[model samples]
Target: MDKNELDKRIADLQAERERLTGELDKARTEARDAMIAGQKPGGTAAALAERLSIVDDALAELQDRTRSAADSAERNNRKRRAESALEATSKRSKLAAAVDEALNALASSWDAYADALRKDVGQVSGAGGDLTAVERALTNNRAAEPLVKALIQSGGVKLARTFGIDTPIRERHAISLADAENRVAESLRVELLRVKAESPQPNVSREAQAELEKMETAR
Candidate 1:
């Protein structure tokens, strides 16, 4: 090919390499922002992989064009430009991988925190009931005041402190006291069963020995 034609091809490859480098930079920035914003696990990794694929394609094209260019100063400049683009792409890929790992860790932390909160709140609310039920039960005059106080404090004193309410007791009514006590007992029973089932231990003799012996004989 003519010198002029070779120079034009080299220039085109150089421009394409620069464009790909810019795209890699943009992708790395986006991935970093997503990590800071606490994106879900694997999202950043997928994005980084996509950007790396583009970089690989552009690098291959740059290499082919550089090899076909005529031996001259223009060819040397294009080769240097290709090398710089490859280096930038490599750096951005590493940065993207780091960001993805960080975001995944953050997502795991958030999930663990949420799960713990759910368990804590569930303990206070009891089965088949909401926080309001627990609050009303605590208002009953018949309810054990110490137990009620512990429940309120366990749910975080900040809630009561924020609303300027008493730590142990809120507004109480005499008429609903009996009903509240009954509801509280039922809720506590259900919660106790749930806890027991979650951590059950073997009790070999809880049932009648005759029935156990019969079952053993049958086996």
Candidate 2:
């Protein structure tokens, strides 16, 4: 049965229990009066005992019904909670996955743009700040333009003419774009897990609360 129905039934049963208790008390009073007035009292005593038994049995049955209704309510609540958790998980998973796809696309596009930019500027500083700005532009809109316009705006794209086309810059190997992309990957992984873990519903098991302990020191 539903919670409201169960609650009404419990309230009705409680009222019945109260009525039974009152009847039991009245019966005891009647039996005592019979004994005080010099009547045999045997009949009243016998009836009182029986009424007591009836009240006890009725109370036991009501207690059982109360417990059963409580158990049912708990089961229903659990079913709803599980369904909600599943729905939340699905939504969060999709959001995190979308984030992953978007970042990956940005990285790929940025890598291509960086390659072109590098060639045009003859392997300019492989600074993460430059690529980061480009990556942001890929996601947003870039204020920087190309050739004449860009050159006029940002001074100009200057190259180290001392380095030959075949030679490396300052005798140091060019850093792969993958290195910066790795940093992005690490950042994404943490954010993805955070997205998955952040929930209004309790993720911790009820039983686990007992076993949890405060750490004395870092491992």
Best prediction by TM-score: 2
Candidate 2 residue-wise lDDT at 28: 70
Which lDDT value does model 2 have at 27? 70
Note the residue pairs that clash in candidate 2: none
Candidate 1, 1-219: lDDT as tens digits: 555665676577567657666766777677788779997444554655576677567657655655665346677899899999999999999999997997698469645644554565555554554344334333335543433443344444554455454554642322233344455565565455545445545342333344444545866
Top candidate (lDDT): 1
Q: Candidate 1, which ten residues in sequence have the lowest lDDT sum?
A: 170-179
lDDT of 2 by residue, 1-219 (tens): 555765676577567667766776777778788879986554654665576577567657766776887898799999999999999999999999997997698569756775665553322222212334224223334332221122223332232221112222231322334544454454444444444445344553322332232111311
Backbone steric clashes in candidate 2, count: 0
Give candidate 2 misplaced runs (Cα > 4 Å): 1-39, 121-219
